[model samples]
Target: MTTQHRTIAFIGAGNMTQSIVGGMVASGYPADAIFVSNPSPGKLEKIAAELGVHTSQDNAEVANKADVIVLAVKPQLMADVCAALREQVAHLADKLIVTIAAGIRISKYRQYLGDDIRMIRVMPNTPSLVGKGMSGLVADDRVDDSDKSFITTAFDGVGATLWVSDEDELDILGAVAGSGPAYFFEFMASLQKAAVALGFDRDKARQMVQQTALGAAEMAIHSELELEDLRKQVTSKGGSTAKGIEQYQAYDIDKISADAVKAAVKRNQEMAELF
Candidate 1:
């Protein structure tokens, strides 16, 4: 089915949902067919005004009106939100339920929304706000191929997507790509600070860092060579890049990055348990 025929209801009108809605509308999906619900009328008003999508304060109202329901609320509030919609979900066997709330597993949702719900769990990062997201998706066995294709198409409007076999992989990808943007941001900030300390202005440092980063990432995406080969190409035998690489190796940066990802994974597990 085409996007125009599908009515997607966003249960929360947050930045991420707004981003998805914006991308969908830009990609030719009918804005009038999209519905957004938020507890706060201010967000709903802004989204409706900006995207021209329908908005509501009642989650169930939105859910009842759509073929797809997106649970975009925070994990801490998911239980309460699901509880409020439990009754309306009984006849939703034909509808697709997609959750973007992190750490809340499918089992927890089943406990409230029912075991037979055609649910899919998606882990998407904040970069989706700029239409450059990396999303990891996993779905319940009950979700058919058509549902999977439709959901994948929707996310593709924002950026790339991957389908993993199990929900555990979502947690792992969450550690990698879901929280990955912040790691890059931190690295860029460090570069900017070092450049400033070396006598460059902050704006010039940031511009240099951002453009270099953009170029490097684009090269990686388009290059057939391995990343290590790309690095080798940039580093001369005794040049500045080689010296920088030597310092990075000397500091065990690879191990530090691995440990950081492991910590994020552990914290994700902790959140799954807590929320």
Candidate 2:
């Protein structure tokens, strides 16, 4: 199976689906080979008009045609969606099923689809909209290498990919990379508020904080040094940067971050039980 020739179908035309589709097309995945379906026509219309992919209101119709089916719907709706596609199981048995819904485990999917279904679970972040997302993937042992390669290539168009050894780790990855963007956004919002308190206008404060965040992230990506080293490089002994660092340390930022990640992981577990 050549990845390029594989017809990929997105079962839901939500934002994440749109972002992945947009990124894939932007990265030169053939739009004609992509199929998308949704119960509602509005998003379908927008995506088809914008990206030129095949669109349908019928889930089974797209599933029948696709070599790879991406289940991009919300977690709460997953059971119903899979139930609707149960009639087409015979037709879909050989195709790869890729799911992006969080918290739902592969076992749950096997229960929904079939006991022998070859599936891959992916946790992707919002940054995929801009071609810089991080996706963590875990695949069933039954999935072939060729299918793995195809899924990897498909996601790489949107961002970097990491394959975890266990499905349990996928939840941990979800806590970090999955919910990580909002953490940075919160910090940036705090900085913007501080800047406003110090007399900078809201817009200017936001602009400064956002650009600095981007620059810091880019530096971390390109630099060989560890994050602690990078922070030290910015802070001279007893300087203003050191003072700020002292405040963060005094506030137990490490503990705060750990607690946040733990909370996210706990919520993921809860969702799994619910689904």
Candidate 3:
């Protein structure tokens, strides 16, 4: 088996895997180069038809044919998949493993493979399906500069990438940036309903909330100032915006957000220890 190129083989053909595969294909990877495999032949065929990539039901075939093998299967299946391909992974002296499953550590990779195995653990969010996600990447000690650079380039196809050395910080980023989009989306949904309650048409309400959310995000993304500064910029002395800020503060929304992220990160750490 060869592990020589960006010819990625995803073990799971689910949505997250497809999000990555679609992003790679859209980023100029040849269809012939990518491969996908699953336990179900029908599922593999479906993904193959959609991406025009090589597909197979045999995980071993994917192990043999692919260079960069992605451990995209669920956490519960991780051990089985790793143990199944332990030899193949060991044979991947040159290939790099990139994992997207949350809370799984590099040590777990070594546990499933060997202590000296080369691997990268990545945490990406659901929004990646639309190419607007952010991912946190951490490389094991065995991974070299070239390996690190390739991962950055590969995940960069989706949205943004943040490289971290401390794997624990990954949990912090995961609970917030990785899971943060859903919260904002839910807030937008609520705001849309609020607009409609004020007699706006459904479409108009949706447009108002959606565009406001997008514009706020764009403003933050393009700004040089910190979030505090950005928030202040929208508030005037004794204005409606200030009054809204006072209300949010009175309700302790800031503390609520902080507590939420802290709780989430804690849950992740606990899961990691158990998993």
lDDT against the true structure, each candidate: 0.90, 0.91, 0.83
Supply every candidate's count of residue pairs whose N, Cα or C atoms clash at under 3 angstroms. Answer: 0, 0, 0
How far off is residue 55 in model 3, in Å?
1.1
- Give the Cα error of residue 273 in candidate 3, in Å: 2.1
Q: What is the TM-score of each candidate against the true structure?
A: 0.96, 0.96, 0.91
Tell how far residue 95 is off in model 3, in angstroms.
2.2
Q: Write one digit per residue (lDDT tens) for candidate 2, span 215-234.
A: 99999999999999999999
Q: What tens digits encode model 1's per-residue C-alpha lDDT throughout 112-218?
A: 78777879999998889899999999998998888898888889889999999998888899999998999999999999999999999999999999999999999
Winning model by lDDT: 2
What would the C-alpha RMSD of candidate 3 be, to one decimal place? 2.4
Top-TM-score structure, candidate number: 2
User: Which ten contiguous residues of candidate 2 have the minimum total lDDT?
Assistant: 86-95
Candidate 3 lDDT, tens digit per residue, 136-192?
A: 998878888877877787788888999987788899999898879877887788888
Residue 137, candidate 3: how far off, in angstroms?
A: 0.6
TM-score computed on alpha carbons, candidate 3:
0.91
